[model samples]
Target: MMDPQIERKLIEIMRVIHESDKPIGARAIADELNNRGYDIGERAVRYHLRILDERGFTSKHGYAGRTLTELGEREMNEALIADRFGFVISRIEEMAFRTSYNPETNEGVVPVNISYFDKDDLETVIEIVSYTAHEGYMISPRVRIIEEDEELFSLPPGKIGIATVCSVAFDGLLLKAGIPVEPAYGGILQIENRKPARFSDLISYSGTSIDPIQIFMSRRTTSVLDVLEKGEGKILANIRQINLSAYERAREIMEKVEKVGLAGYFPPGEVGETLLGAPIETGKFGIAIVGGINGICALEETGIKIKTNPVSTVMEYKTMTEI
Candidate 1:
């Protein structure tokens, strides 16, 4: 793999060329990159272009600058996605760090998953979310509701927003106690008799730019409603690994959070073992978290047109109300 710095410059240069009406020169590309806050000079731009040319991503027009080749455009598109890879993992860490909800007082901010649905579906939305909470499929029964025309994330016209406590609250709590957590992936976990069975699908956070849950939602793969009713089906879940040595401390924090009305997690599996069928590294144990978006998954199963941004933002615990 090329150095990240060089790769970024190459992608940007390709972008500038692709966006130009005519093949753009190294000087123009360098100037554009500079204006865009990159410290690249024409010499640097030319050096990067040679690399791109070697990769068949750009073609030199002699003194006419360079143009992105067919292969180059495709590579650029994939590179853009690659550049954003692990964004979900980064967001997870960011939100986890931002979380300050103390189990003792429960008065600090907690991470939340945001969803927007038609205002006309308010009655049904409430019913579904409440049912999910009752079924213990949500991170917490608490939720923050925003009516249309409210000052919040761009709520679409005629849409209302529902913010549910995210499972990352567990990560935050454990982290506050000095335990390191590595969120491995978001997956669809099979359930049996209301107990987690195994993961039937997974998307590792390290390889994806988009949240894995959103991808599963797009596929309409969750059987959250089925699991709620029949006690068997798949639901959105995430797997996180922690050092085996911190197991006891992590358990203590888990107990505290559960008492504060935030519930999500399976006890750690044995070191070097798989939990609910997801593999854990040799020196770590894995904890499976019930996804905070399970409630919304139920709503989607019911044929509601909803848009979701899981692990979107954080909100004060006190600001939300129990369903």
Candidate 2:
């Protein structure tokens, strides 16, 4: 077995090589280690590199420097896995302490139960439960299956069956039919129904509809009302052909906003064209808007329902020009 100290140094050297933009010399590696508070010399680093090269963990190029080999990469990955396991265990312990119950005093006693299921059965149950919950209803985490002989699929008139046979049947039908069951955000833009028209309406309301696809492509317009009017067919086609690169850029911009502490909800940005039964296409040409809750709210003010999921609250519109 390799000495623990030597193994640790070899791993650290491998990490430095993996993180470098180009092959690095032993002197540079020693300098970097010293900067990180390690008390190692250039000669010692070269000796370690020779040992690593002999073990097929590093490749030495005469003038260029040294680089990690595939074996070295695997070693670094293993180190990362070990670190992640330690992190997870630490967090679990923290949670246990936070939720610890004093049995003698009967304090901090939050009753909870754990359930286990076969992998296949658990996946099926999760799919059904997820679909039901996405429809905006609270559901019980505890699942119960009735035996064939004692099956009771229905409830009394007043007691609603949360996950009844009919509901599951409908979900299955939708799945089999290849109908998309994910919820989406975006709707028709409307201006007047919520309040009485004021003098500012003349300047703020431009009567002309804006194309959401154009706004998405440009990444400049704040509101959906800024794009040039286009036909619905053209808009939908453009939306279908949206450049994925632009979407990534928009996501980065939204992340910067959250990092600055302005956004109320910072969702892991995933840009897509559809949600559940609601397509991102609004009926009016150019007035269509697509985004998360805030975007949905913008269209909802005009009184259009946008389908969303339980996790939708974490998402916010990316079109806002300001915080």
How many angstroms is residue 215 displaced in model 2 relative to the true structure, after the best TM-score fit?
30
> TM per model?
0.76, 0.28
lDDT of 1 by residue, 1-323 (tens): 66787777787788778755457788878766664446889998888888888889888888877788999989887876766777578778888888898778767998898898888899999888988887877789999898765644445567789999998898898898999899888889899999988899998888887788789878989998898889999888888999989988988888877887888677778888988778889999988888898989899999998877777678899999988
Candidate 1's C-alpha runs over 4 A off are 1-79
The residue pairs that clash in candidate 2, if any, are 182-275, 182-276, 183-275, 183-276, 184-275, 210-286
Q: What does the lDDT come to for candidate 2?
A: 0.35
Best by lDDT: 1
- Worst ten in a row by lDDT for model 1: 148-157
Model 1 C-alpha RMSD to native: 8.7
The per-residue C-alpha lDDT of model 2 at residue 18 equals 75
Where is model 2 poorest over a 10-residue stretch in terms of lDDT?
Answer: 231-240
- Model 2 agreement with the true structure over 1-323: per-residue lDDT tens digits: 87877777777788677756568888878876654346899999999999999989999888778889898888777764443333322322222222322223323311111122223343344443333223211112222332223222212122221111111111112223332222122222222322111111110111112222223323322222211111111111111112343444434433443343222221222334332222333321111112222222223233332222211000111211121
